[model samples]
Target: MWQFLKTWYHRLASPKWFYHTSGRWLPYLAAVTILLLVSGAIWGLGFAPEDARQGNSYRIIYIHVPVSVLALVGYYLMAVAGAIALIWKIKLADMVMVSAAPLGAVLTFLALLTGSIWGKPTWGTYWEWDARITSMLVLLFLYLGVLALSRAFTSRDTAYKACAILSLVGTVNIPIIYKSVDWWYTLHQPATIKLTGGSTIHPAMFKPLLVMIIGFYCFYALVLILNTRAEILRREQRSAWVRELI
Candidate 1:
């Protein structure tokens, strides 16, 4: 099992292998992403029961929660890729780290946008310095910081090292973001979906939420693969294989 894992790790670390394999995955991934997103949207927004308290406005959770969850998850992915690149000296890992930064930033912005839209109805205001929201704002900056650092240097190695360091250092904020609501007195609601004690949401609502979460994950994966493949092509443009393919 260890040998199997090691062999696959080496295979995946190869940019050419990932580029070819992920190309095969793209069509099926795009199809599944579209199907899941459309079905989940119709189920959550159109068919699910309205919130007794927040009413129809709460339906935004179908979009908000999934993006919010994935924004945090994306940061983890970026940081891990950075770590791998720094330690293993894998060019593919650097490509993945770079690809994830902008995507995570976009998702974080969407989470904040939808949260604000949801807030006006529930919190009587669109913007607040609530712990969760503020931490998420900080997260956006962290992602932006990584993006900025990644491009600041003319040398790719320098940029990768700088971005890797920033990503690793910035990870301290992730835990703060996760525990903010629990640790503070804030208007932001506690997580509705819990892994340990079971979700607090009604089954009808939970089902669609679950579907949306999975759909968002698929979407994230699809985009990451597409972005990484593009990065591989750009970086490998001078290689014999890339030259031949082009």
Candidate 2:
């Protein structure tokens, strides 16, 4: 079992192996991503019943909630990849970290944008300096900082190390973002979904949300894999395997 695990990790850490392996899976992933996203979007936005309170405006939850969840989860993935690159000096991990930055930034931006839109009706304002919203804004800047620092250094190793440390340091904000609504009185509502206790949401509404969340997760993985593949090809352009594939 240990040997099998080690072999799997070794293959995963290998750029050439990942490049070839990902190619075979990309088509299937793309198909699944498209199908789920389309179905979930249509179901959630068009078919799901309106909320008792928020009415049609609440429909934005279909996109807002899913992207907000993805944004936080993506930040964690970015931080973990950065930590792996720094701790193990893994080139593949570094590539994953770099590729994750911009994608995470976009997701964060979407989260903020959609949240602001959702807030207009619910909170009677489009913008608020509440703890949750402010911390989320900081999260966006953290992602952008990683992107900026990566390009600031001429030395690749220096850039990777810098981004790694920045990502790790920025992780402090994640918990702050998660707990901001609880830590202080804020316009943002407390979480409807809970891990331990049963969810506050009705199952009828939650089912389409579940589908959207799953579809969003698949979409995130699809983007990450494609981005990492592009980064790998560019970084490994001079390698024999990359040359042969080209």
Candidate 3:
């Protein structure tokens, strides 16, 4: 078992091996992602009950909650991939980290936009400098910084190293973003979906929210795999395998 695990781990460290493995999983991941997203969207948009307070506007939770969660998870993933790339000099790891950045930025933007939309109906305003919201904005900026820094250097090796360091440094912002609501009194409500305290939200609303979160996670995996594959192709363009495949 140990030998098997080590072999698999070492295999993944190779760009070609990682590319082929990811390719095998891509179709399955994509199919599941689409299935979950469509199912969740239909359920959330069509069947979920209207909020007693916010009415139809609360329906945006389907997109808002999932994207917000992904913003944090995505950053962590990029940082971890960066760490792996730096430590092992694994081309696949660097590619995964690079591919993750734009997607993370987009998710952060969606979260902020949807939050604004949800806010107008509930808070009677489209924007506020609340702790949660402010921290989220900062998180978005961090994503941009990593993306920019990664492309700034003339040498790819130097670029990857610089981006890796920046990614590690930026990880500090994630905890700040997560705990901002707890540390500061904010207009944004405390977690409605708590594990131990019992969810403040009704079960009807909660169900679709869970489904949507899962769907969004699946979607991220799908995109990440596809993007990683593309990066592999580009990086290995000179290789016999890539040339033959192309």
* Models sorted by TM-score, best on top: 1, 2, 3
Best model per TM-score: 1
lDDT of 1 by residue, 160-218 (tens): 99999999998999999988989996799988888789778999998998899999999
Task: Encode model 3's per-residue lDDT on 1-246: one tens digit a residue.
Answer: 999999989887887887888888888888888888888888889999988877888889899999999999999999999999999898888999999998999999999999998998799988999999998999899899989987898898998998888889999989888778778977988778866777789899889889889989999988888888888888889999888775
Error of 2 at 150 (Å): 1.1
Rank by lDDT, descending?
A: 1, 2, 3
Best by lDDT: 1
**Better structure of 1 and 2 per TM-score:** 1
TM-score of each: 0.98, 0.97, 0.96
Q: State residue 189's C-alpha deviation in candidate 3, in Å.
A: 1.1
lDDT of 1: 0.95
Per candidate, the number of residue pairs that clash is: 0, 0, 0
Misplaced by over 4 Å in model 2 are none
Error of 3 at 52 (Å): 1.2
